[model samples]
Target: MMTNTQTSSSTERIAAEAPLIERLRAGDDGAFAELVSTHTGRMLVVARRVTGSEADAEDAVQEAFISAFKNIEQFDGRSTLGTWLHRIVVNAALMKRRRKRSRPETSIEQLLPQFDDGFHREKPQSIEVVTNGGGGSIVEREAVMAALDELPDEFREVIVLRDVEGLDSKSAAESLGISDSLVRQRLHRGRQALMKLLERRMKGIES
Candidate 1:
């Protein structure tokens, strides 16, 4: 019997790679369009999570596609094209951020976490509040998005990749060029951080 975790991991792995494998390998034009349609939104979301700016995310995604097309020949069927494209996008986004940080090296230090410890472990309390009608009708869906904006970029990126983009730990780790264990740790810590942020925001509102 497949454990729930194994089933989820298998399902995500299959979903993430199957389309690119089919369309790109077969040289099907419609497959390319299908690929774009299937991944563009989530790619943008991941890009935005990494770059922390929609404009940068847009640029990163465009550049990633360009890179992916150029590198398609290098793609072995060993991994999905979506995974390949995601790595390209992340590199592009990181390069853009590095360019932006050129003037102030301090920003790099500020952005990256100092330690691997899961310092931010608990999720924002807002989820409970939101579930319990704490905000009632006042907080719109956009507010939740904005709350995500409040998280540190790294935390947001891991969470968005794992929870929002629906990437498994392996693919997410591969995309980020990190270990799978690290991806799992980040995802756990990221969820905790977001939950903590939400809780704090909710308390502030009620007070």
Candidate 2:
């Protein structure tokens, strides 16, 4: 929960950004530079989590910045600049991911949880999906990340956008050019696969 002071500070920050948004709309080069310098790190974090490749992430950020600059005029104050850019970055990263030759979706089925006649074959352990900079030891975090990369593109993209990037299902669906129901389905299965992979990875590390 946000305190009153935090709420007030947030309101003030948004108000302060009004002028910068206006300048950006007016084609102020300085404002554009300022926006890039200030928000590039945030955008890069989202891009990296989505693409899982430094080169791809860098390319996505570049594409996102270009899209942001070109579409600044359409940005209403309904959403914060950060929120807007976050969506742009997700879209850019998803596009880059699509351009790559992807593995078969069938490969991910083997990674998901197994069940028998509407019941688990074995009781599964609860495993948390750790997003970038989320709580966990460095080793656990790295293992979780590696597990994420091992997921097939179909499931991995949804998990990264919904869980890692913190986008809602509808937004993630739009970014992925899929339906909201598909986003939900993929996220559910993606999390299961991620946990199972992480469990094996941790066991390997322990041994």
> RMSD, each candidate, Å?
7.0, 5.2
Candidate 2 positional error at 60, Å: 1.2
Minimal lDDT window, size 10, model 2: 1-10
Q: Each prediction's Cα lDDT score? A: 0.66, 0.79
* Pairs of colliding residues, candidate 2: none
lDDT of 1 by residue, 1-207 (tens): 111333446456767776656677677887778777877886787777677689999999988887876777678756555567777887788777656643322122233333448674433233564546655555734455655665655556667677766778887787778889988887776665555556556555521
Total colliding residue pairs, candidate 2: 0
Native-vs-model 1 lDDT? 0.66
Question: What TM-score quantifies how close candidate 1 is to the native fold?
Answer: 0.62
TM-scores of the models, in the given order? 0.62, 0.77
Q: Give the alpha carbon lDDT tens digit for every residue of 45-81 in model 2.
A: 8888878888999999999999999998898766567
